[model samples]
Target: MGVHGTVAAGFEGVREEFSAFLTDEEHAPGAQLVVHQGGERVVDLWSEGVGGESLLGVFSSTKGAAYLVTALLVQDGFLDLDRTVASYWPDFAAEGKGGVTLRELLAHRAGVIGLDAGFTAEELADDRAIAARLAGQRPFWQPGRFFGYHAFVIGALVGEVVFRATGRTLQECYEERIRAPYGLDLWLGLPQSQEPRFLSTLPMLPTPEQAAEIEAAAASPYSLGGIAFNEHAPGNGELYDFPNSRAVRAGGQASAGGLGSARGLAGMYAAAAFGLNGRAPLLKPDTAAEFARIHSEGTDLVGGMPKAFGLGFQSYGAHFPVLGAGAFGHSGASGSLALADPRQGFAYAYTRRRYAFPGGAAPENTRLLGAVVRALT
Candidate 1:
């Protein structure tokens, strides 16, 4: 019934909002929330079902880290945004994808969302395997002509470029340059020592009405959305089960396999936009701006809904009105949301053990973010 952790004096409203939302929930959500104002921790709260140190799978929010790594490479001049992906990974040019640029691929414009034949569960857990399979697959649409949410494969596409350019995996780069240096809890490839802290993600418990609506809106496995999520695969399990598998957690599929708590999620963004733990900020202003600027807006070809995307992160400004322009971050399928708002001088993160109904960013984020902004003002 009570919330855990501390908030700065002025941020009591955020605690109140978090508690209010929990009180109304029929099920325990096992949630964690963390916020950083520049380099200072302002709010750190967790629900009864999850502790401040507990780690949960942060689905697509993993993409933010992947994107950040890519941004760093670009900032260092190791990678070029405008260069054709084929220029770096020659095999990527196969199947009429010779012209897909790194910029377009990061923007979800490459159209090679997933392999037509589908990936094995084992392959889905490995980014290199996923990349190899996708290399020969034809684009779902003409490259750069339209945009779709490359829900499951964007990381592999970008990671491939990173590997080709630097001779290291994205996870390796993230660990050496980002995670280990900051001692962040977020893990792209979680080590065995950290295994004890992980709390396996729970599936969504939708209300009867929500369940009925989902059933009504269900698309065929052959549909674009289905393929993007690899649901069309012959033996694919439910998307929620991906993180439960040890292989998936061990390999850290760049797309959605990150494991972390709210602290790690929030801290990673803080390190990117504002220096953390006395370290300098990871991203330069120009690099962050280029990655955060809206590159694709309007209907997503895969999701069949209005969406907005920056290089590899979601355009937070479009989805959360409280977030100012250029705010960038991403949400996970399990209701985890994390982002950095350089304009507002804060980085925020929220993670849940249980999936929320109508997934993506979870409904509670709006009120919670508004409360945080009000407290900041």
Candidate 2:
């Protein structure tokens, strides 16, 4: 099926790139792409199997919202990055993580990647439960010595602090200060009324060679990476199915349960960095820079790849050549990518219903993003 949407006059290249990407895929991706120049949406498009407004699981891209909320709280002086996790949630000190500061946790250096006993599906569905269980767990590495991807629990770790400091859940903070104020389509806690718009994320259809590679590279379920992704849990469902559960979406796990369309992702970033809907930017210039600054780099212990992060956000500029050094955001397992390039004066988001091979941001993003830059120039 042909792509359906509108692109501002100068952004026709983006449409071409999007169409070409769909044509190249062996299976339909059910993708949505949106970009905002300051507060103006320059491109809005979707493909077969989904509508432009349909919400899909955004996986770790939800972490971008979690981090953005943290940044706003810091900007308002409600939370201090230098404070120890134990200072906020006292039980966090039960482990050797007493010295681990909010900054260290945001950088993925607190080292409590997962529990010695993996979380059950019910516990994993609740952020507070995840935090409660992990609070007394030991760090995989010496706290503050190294950084790795928290994968499924960063939101809970951070959210616990948010609650202890402000008597509010991160999801509550996000909805009140960010989502509801701007009327963003993204939701940490999806309501029953929005159920009809959500499309279940389809599993990846990897080629034979890709499947072989995946099997060859598979880590033991008990390995650190496995634990981080909750693969070690007995009878745990596939990662792709996490958000499909009404319980997961209702509780709003925060780490990966976010559901929204590309427009919502784009608008959130636009509001945070560029002031969407003619409102003042949610974050100050200094706050944005601090979160965008590189906090960790080099091979990740959990992902086993060269990765970089800034406060809880991925340093997208390092991964996407078309973006500026200040571009910060996150990607999800369903090949979703959303970010704000403050230096470039734009925010971009792409969400796909079908899981992309290799399980991360879809490779087509580079081509699409390059096309956007070309159009802007």
Sequence-dependent TM-score of model 2: 0.99
> lDDT scores for all predictions?
0.92, 0.92
After the best TM-score superposition of candidate 1, give how far the Cα of residue 263 lies from its true spot, in angstroms: 0.4
The alpha-carbon lDDT assigned to residue 118 of candidate 2 equals 95
Question: All candidates: CA RMSD in angstroms?
Answer: 0.9, 0.9
Please, what are the lDDT tens digits per residue for candidate 2 over residues 1-377? 68999999999999998988686454485899999998899999999888998999999999999999999999999899999989988999986789999999999998889988799999999999999999999899998889999999999999999999899999999999999999999999999999999999888878889999999999998988999998988888999999899999998889999999999999999999999887999999999999999999998999899998999999988988889998999999989999999989999999999887787788888898999999988
Looking at model 1, report the run of 10 residues with the lowest lDDT sum.
21-30
The collision pairs in model 2 are: none
Query: Clash number for every model?
Result: 0, 0
| Alpha carbon lDDT at 118, candidate 1 | 90
